[model samples]
Target: MGLIKTVGLTKTYNGTNAVDGIDLSIKEGVCTALLGPNGAGKTTTLNMLTGLINATSGTISFDDRYMGDRRKYIGYLPQYPKFYGWMTGEEYIIFSGQLAGLTKKEALSRSDELLSLVGLSEDKKKRVSGYSGGMKQRLGIAQSLIHSPKLLILDEPVSALDPIGRREVLELMKTLKEKTSILFSTHVLHDAEEICEEIFIIKKGKLIIEGDLVELQRKYQKPTIYLNTEEPIEDWSTTIKQKEWLRHMDVKKNKITVTVEDMDMAREALLTDESLRKLKINSFEVAKTTLEDLFMEVTGK
Candidate 1:
């Protein structure tokens, strides 16, 4: 059973359905990603789930175990979080706790614990205005956890950061997944592949795919090999193009990527080919279809 489930969830604006009738099931105690290109209604779906907005025509159901106001069971961090520049990171968390109904003493205690969890304890005293992009994101995550909700939702958490900042937040998310159920939205396929167990892909406001990441990968996987040489291999690829085991081959500059019907036969043929032996191979790798490949195939991008 899902910790949270949506049935035909939808939202509309100006006679157009921004979020079409899409169903979702978010399992507990694991990381799940809502993936789509920009303007695919990812934010709208999340907003409805977090109670930030009402669904136009659908049901947002939490487990019966979590009764009363749904907001109490959810922690939400928006794509662009706003913070009081004048307040210190420590003070901001405490304030968020209070707003979430924590007593002053409880808020203070929770602030310390959460700040430590996000690795912002040392900089807790610093004003929010002085923090870097990554530091501020960590602070926002801490504030969200101040309430200790059952589910944590983050919208495009690392989308705006530099490489260094993106890495910092991604690593923090890896740690947080062990402690809580996380539902995060992102268009970056690599980040989702790194941390999520399940994924739901949306396109043009419609739910196109949803399943366990590993299972989906295996289901859509193709037998493929990547070869890069010190020199161009266009001529050599043409030589093997007629082989029955070779399904398709793509050559770009000094690299050749091939899809094969029989991996064992293709491997044997390529490894023993005299023409290939004469070339100085930079690298050769055997790989299955990746999430990015799957995404491109489904999204038609």
Candidate 2:
């Protein structure tokens, strides 16, 4: 069995189905990205998987045991966590470790180590009330790791951070991968493309696509050719239309963009076209589609 599995998971709120028959499997030792737009049921799904909210129907299993029986092995970071405002970061981590059933000595040692790991060792004694949002997030991550759980679930962990803070958190997450499997939910496509080994793209609470990065890129990458000519290429569109390999062509200023079925054929044609040589083409390049483009294409936004 995979480290985490949700089978036919469904959640409904006041007669509205928020999560509808979603199934997912996350293997151990890899980071998986749960991607969706707002109100896509990502939060609800995470809650159900963690047993914070019971699913309306379906089952979640971890390591062959049901979710309820596997709580000790899972560590969760909610979207907006609430911590005692007066408690220092170190104290809070100790409390979390104790709650997770660690002994006092173990809790203290783990708290210190985790605080340092998340880059909060210097501010370990600072009250949470004085902590910034990013700092609080780092604390939350440290708290979640206190017990050394097998699976870590982070809900929009880097969403509220600045670029530098986000980079720090991403690096921390990468560092933690050796000890824990991560299931991270976020609307940020670039983050997923950067760190996640596998991804599940959901729209309106339904699983639209799930796969490794390379396969997802291959499936959604748009076939487009870019050409820059010495002068304005108004006739280039009409000329490309005559070629059987060309699907469509668009001309903008001195550049002509073409879409074709096969990029190799398009590249060969562009390189070998004698007429284009005579016209003094300045540059010819193919534009590969990105994760952002794939998200927009799949979600139609």
- Which candidate comes out best when scored by lDDT? 1
Residue-wise C-alpha lDDT for candidate 2, range 1-301, written one tens digit per residue: 8898989899988898899889999989899999998889999999998889999998888886534477778889999889999999999999988988899999999998999999999999999999987888889999988767889999999998898779888998989887799999999898998888899998887899998977888877778888888877886556777777887676887888776888888889888878787778888888865678669767775
Q: Give each model's whole-structure lDDT.
A: 0.91, 0.87
In model 1, the clashing pairs are none
Best by TM-score: 1
Candidate 1 local accuracy as lDDT? 0.91
TM-score of each: 0.85, 0.84
lDDT of 1 by residue, 1-301 (tens): 6989999999999889999998999999999999999988999999999999999998989988999987888989999999999999999999998998899999999999999999999999999999999999999999888778889999999999999899999999999999889999998888899899999999988999999999988887888999999878988888998999988788998899898899999999988888897887888899875767779767765
> In model 1, what lDDT does residue 190 have?
84
Q: Once model 1 is optimally superposed onto the true structure by TM-score, how far is the C-alpha of residue 159 displaced, in angstroms?
A: 1.1
